[model samples]
Target: LDFSIDELAGNVATGADTLSIALCKVSAPTKEPWLTLSYDEWICVLKGRVLVHHAEGTLEAKAGETIFVSKGERFRPEFPDAGTEYLPVCLPAFRPDRCIREDESDATVGQQVNDMHAKLQVAEVLYHMCSKEDWEKSKADNAAYFPPMFDKDGFTHATSVPSLLLTVANNFYQS
Candidate 1:
């Protein structure tokens, strides 16, 4: 899959219960760190390079190299130059709610840090159903645009918990 450096947007390439593959792009330097609370991630560089700063130390990854960030490890990724593109394969998929931005207030971070363990223990797995054809299309195009209906409705649909996953998949997708 190919992408223009100007596209800073990211999208899920494909996913399953335990992991998800994502195509990520950064057009400009990031101003803050990003904390992934729910899953570990490995960023494989496809073009250009990025400096990954983690609790232990900082490392630079060039094209063809990769970096791993453990779950709960706060890290910041800085794109040294333009045309930075990478693939982040995340364990347990990626959810917006589980991703904490660095701009969050101190109080919020403190509370989340305090409740981290408890939250992790009871975290439920949510699922989103999609067609195999659509997944293949995304893989081929190197872009995963929102489902067509989402443009009309302005929202993506998802199953809230594991229990509903099978029923929803069976009802909507034949293959």
Candidate 2:
């Protein structure tokens, strides 16, 4: 590959799954295949230039310039100038699996994105470590569960990711 991408802020890089920032460096000429992205992309150029070909026309951006491409738009990115450096910011983060190529059915990706949105609407389970006695009390009262330290801390801690449950519990609730 003539290009290299380094993620600055993202799920794997900084755990910010809602957004992504990546530094892309193109050292040689290359024109990627047409594809429709599942997430919006905003690019800012630092060196050289970039040309994005889409159905409407071609969008060009030179050094010190920027370009915006909406998601679900069929487009191809070309780096005609060597040593091109740019930063791409994406909403909802950019994932390789969400990049649907022109050869691939657009409907399939649409449905997948839709299903993902639906799943998100289903609700996420928040993990809160507490004593079995406290848990039973909450279930019996059918109200919010408050820890004994609630009066001291005036706050309740919770995590949406299940993996962090143990780490948080060990660090804060270690007996």
Candidate 3:
């Protein structure tokens, strides 16, 4: 599909009860920091490059690269070098109410978390990889947990050992 620099363009390609896929086209450089409370997002970059900055650190992905941002992980994605086209596959479908912007002011952190859990239940432990900087910062702050982006949403995204972690990385995250 065609894209325009004046707008952020995207469309849901397909969706099911548990998942959905969307094609996103960004024609200009931009940065958006966001957290998804109810679902996980796996992005496959088709063209250009994007730098994703998370609580832990930053990862740069270019064409044919993929990035998985677990639920509750707060991250700011910057399309820096050029416009980008990507596909975002979200588990459990993506909803506006569950996607919280970093600067959103209406809900308190506690309320957000409560509301999120009220809607869904999590039964498994997930793992997330962070940058050394974020780890060090947490230590200096004497905080045991570096809250995920969707902490406000009440749940965080994680990958079990047997999940598609390595396969996904190998398939999409390779330089």
Candidate 4:
């Protein structure tokens, strides 16, 4: 019931690749890359409008309207109106491979998504999964070593037991 939309971005909430449903909020007018899907997709707009450009031409859908993109249809989605909220459902889910984006060549939405996913996955693996890299870093660090993301993260994770600090650099941070 309580989950982050960012946590769902570039990833699925269902944990199943067969299907995915996500609510997307676009606060600013933004444009997305041309995407060719391997799965059928339905996008229902909840607020503002969405502009989709395809080979045939362009299609415009506003609030309360729904747009369907069949498999293999290539298109670019744009949110011309700020504060656009929409729900996108994908049949067979939306993997990076399933969503072939043409903007990977540049630092576009696809690249940004991949980058975000990489950072999130790294954090998950290093913190939750306890990778050897974290072990080495934690072991070698004698002083209060905050990771590179400490500033943005605002706090460091610490252990309840001082002796177990070797096992974890930072945990259970309370600010």
For candidate 3, what is the total of clashing residue pairs?
A: 7
* Candidate 3: RMSD to truth: 16.0
Candidate 4 CA-lDDT value: 0.67
| Candidate 1, 44-142: lDDT as tens digits | 999888788777788999999999888888887767766688887767765555667665443333343234323333336556777788878988999
Report the lDDT tens digits of candidate 3 across residue range 72-161.
877876767546887777776654555776644533432533443354433265455555887788889998755454456464433444
List ranges where model 2 is wrong by over 4 Å.
103-159, 162-175
lDDT of 1: 0.63
Taking the tens digit of each residue's C-alpha lDDT, what string does model 2 give over 29-118? 766668788999998999999999989899999999999989888898888998999998989786666677654333443343334334
The candidate that wins on lDDT is 2
lDDT of 2: 0.76
lDDT of 4 by residue, 86-120 (tens): 88888876667677877744435566456534532
Counted clashes in each candidate structure: 0, 0, 7, 3
lDDT of each: 0.63, 0.76, 0.60, 0.67
Quick one: ranking by TM-score, best first? 2, 4, 1, 3
The parts of candidate 1 lying over 4 Å away from their true place are 1-17, 104-175
TM-score, per-candidate, Cα-based? 0.50, 0.62, 0.50, 0.58
Model 4 poorest ten-residue lDDT run: 120-129
